[model samples]
Target: MPDEQGHPELEEIELGKVLAALADPARRRVIKQLLEDEAGAERHCTSFGLQLSKATRSHHFRVLREAGLIRQVDRGNSRMAQLRYGEIELRFPGLLELIRREKEEQASSET
Candidate 1:
């Protein structure tokens, strides 16, 4: 079932879509930023600091949103994105933990 915002319900979230969305480094970076953010704090898309062009960034966000990894809503003139943390955690336990660990490893490797 779809929520009012059109995002997938927790039980309806699919592993394939989620994994496909995270397969893109840019989308994973976006997810990592949201994971690091304070709980329930929606972030403006521009705040992600991605190097992609506006259109490309939009595409990445859209892919994530459609995959049920994140929820996007309009806040005034800007689009806000937030990880579906609790839902994702309950639906696929340890998945976010794995993503967080992966990001940490990548960050350390880049240093």
Candidate 2:
């Protein structure tokens, strides 16, 4: 079960859901960016610079959050996002490193 913030606990993270969430190229890009950013940095939704509809991007963020890949909170008028790196790493070793290594070419698709 997820917490009040809608984030799943480390022990509650399911691999199938995580993989499904990561399957989308756009979502993967989100993860990749989060991975590449400074540790513990919480980025705003607009900071990703995704040339996508606000609704579409919000969907992506929701997917990542529900899948336990990231955490999000309302910051002022916008939402702030951060990779659940340590939690994910504790549950699945080296998973994020693989995302980081994924070729940047695939992230070009804005959808």
Candidate 3:
């Protein structure tokens, strides 16, 4: 698979990198948003509404893309992101579901 702007190839996606990417609360939020989107829908970076500077936001996106958790494509003047759910599931079955469930449980406990 062609790496987009130096993003990791599917075969090169390491568990450590994925776990590290998800370790950040901000990145997890991004993943949660992508998971909530309808299948095959792409989310624009600005649509995330993350309270972060442009450089920081770009860094998070880069981490996600590099971890192979998301695919980004340049559309006109904007960059769109889509979760690579299928690819990740193939490589790490049930991983996303587990993470989502854990996050939900944590949220409920804090409420």
Candidate 4:
């Protein structure tokens, strides 16, 4: 990856933080959105537009980074977030896919 100007790579993150971060619905939505793209897809944390406080957003991202779910770097004025696809896949096989499928099923049913 091109480092997004200032973000740490996946190898620099911790694992436990990622899990704790994803344990929440809001944070899980952030991860799910990022997973929609290929590797190195830089997105703003707020792109999820979750109804959360700014502090909460930062806390969620921090957890994801520490858990190894994402790699974020400062991009000039805004922070860019990217999912650690390969790293996460290696660590947990088919986990993302399964969760995403479940989420889709839930959404469909809700409609």
TM-score of each: 0.87, 0.92, 0.87, 0.75
Q: Rate the local accuracy (lDDT) of all candidates.
A: 0.85, 0.89, 0.84, 0.71
Listed per model in order, the count of residue pairs whose N, CA or C atoms clash below 3 Å is 0, 0, 0, 4
Measured by TM-score, the strongest candidate is: 2
Q: TM-score of predicted model 2? A: 0.92
Candidate 3, poorest ten consecutive residues by summed lDDT: 102-111
Per-residue lDDT of candidate 3, residues 6-55 (tens digit): 56777899999999998877788788878888877899997887889999
Residue pairs with clashing backbones, model 1:
none
lDDT of model 2, residue 66: 93
In candidate 2 the C-alpha lDDT for residue 87 amounts to: 91
Clashing pairs in 4: 7-73, 14-66, 17-67, 18-67
Worst 10 residues of 4 by lDDT: 1-10
lDDT of 3: 0.84
**Candidate 3 clash pair list:** none
Tell me which of candidates 1 and 2 scores higher on lDDT: 2
Clashes of 1: 0
